[model samples]
Structures are given as C-alpha cells and as structure tokens.
Target: MSLFEELLKWDKDQCRVVGKKFELGSWNKLSEKDRLGMIGELIDLLCQRLKIKDKPKVILTTLDNAFGAFSPSENTIYIDRKTLSKGGILTACYCST
Candidate 1:
C-alpha cells in the first residue's frame, strides 16, 4: 500500500514519523506565503479538534517526526496519536497540503 494509505490506517496506538533528513536551506526554499499557509492549516486543525462552535480552549503540543535526533522548527505545531484520538477531530491528513 501507499505511505498515505498506511498513515490513514494508523490508530491511536501508532506513532507516525518522518525518516528523511531535512536542512534549513530546504525549508527556506519555500515562499513565506507557503509557510504561513502550512501554519494556518495546523492551527485550523487544532481549532477543529477543540470543537470551537463559538470560542474554545486549545492546547497544542508539537514535536519532530524524527526519533530523537532533531526537533521541529520553533514555529511548527504537532499532535501525537494519543492526544489526537482523545481530541474531537475525526480525521487527519499528514503531509497532505
């Protein structure tokens, strides 16, 4: 099956990780608009999970996809499987934007 399909099958007990090595230069290649768009999507996902029918409280936890050698950028946001399942969000799309 495809990687996307595999990730789609992930359950609360599973952990998703990225094994590729990335450099700041690679990230810097993206336009500022693209970065903002990515960040916005993450924030929207958080809002969806909090079920913000009007206004809601949100707690976001972020981490690198790597095992332990690297960290996400200061601005990157993440959610683990455990927290994601407990949250009200019904679907997840990884690297899909």
Candidate 2:
C-alpha cells in the first residue's frame, strides 16, 4: 500500500504531543486570501518564538510536485500557489508534522 493509504489507516490518536494544540475554527470555510493571511500570522508567531531577527518573506509561486521551499540565503519561503495551506495547527507551516 502507498504511504498515503498507510497514513489514512493509522489512528491519529496514536501519536501524542505535550504542548497545547492550536485549533482553527471554520478552517475549510476560509477563503484563499484569508488562509494566506493566517499563514502569514503563523509565520510571524514562529519567528517570534524562535527569536528570529528578520521575518522571512513568503512568496507564492507555481511549483511542480512540491508544496514549498525555504531559502536560507534569501531568508524567504516559497509556497506553491496551486496548493494553499491546510488547517490544523502548524499543518500550513510544517505540512503534516
């Protein structure tokens, strides 16, 4: 079976995390523009938490077979315009972590 299938079959509760989990209300109902705004907010929060000096610039682009990439030199994040972020805490930032 594929990895996707295995993930689907696994019980989500099997994994436990200590920190508080953030829950977004009406996630599916949010517009693309709203979602992008949320992503920006998440990034800002993360930067603050990590003590990052300059907030990384987020640029949406047309990518092939990939969701996003981070450039250290440029200090920027590039997300695939075609695939916007999903809900559930840092799912938008970390992608199912």
Clashing pairs in 2: none
Over the stretch 1-97, how does candidate 1's per-residue lDDT look in tens digits?
A: 7755654544322221220111234334545444334334544544454444433223344435621121234333344434333332322333332
Tell how far residue 31 is off in model 2, in angstroms.
1.6
Lowest-scoring 10 consecutive residues by lDDT in candidate 2?
14-23
The candidate 1 region of ten consecutive residues with least summed lDDT is 14-23
Clashes of each: 0, 0
Best by lDDT: 2
The whole-model C-alpha lDDT of candidate 2 against the native structure comes to: 0.60
How many clashes does the backbone of model 1 have?
Answer: 0
Model 2: per-residue lDDT, tens digit, 26-69?
55677777766767776665566455789999888877887888
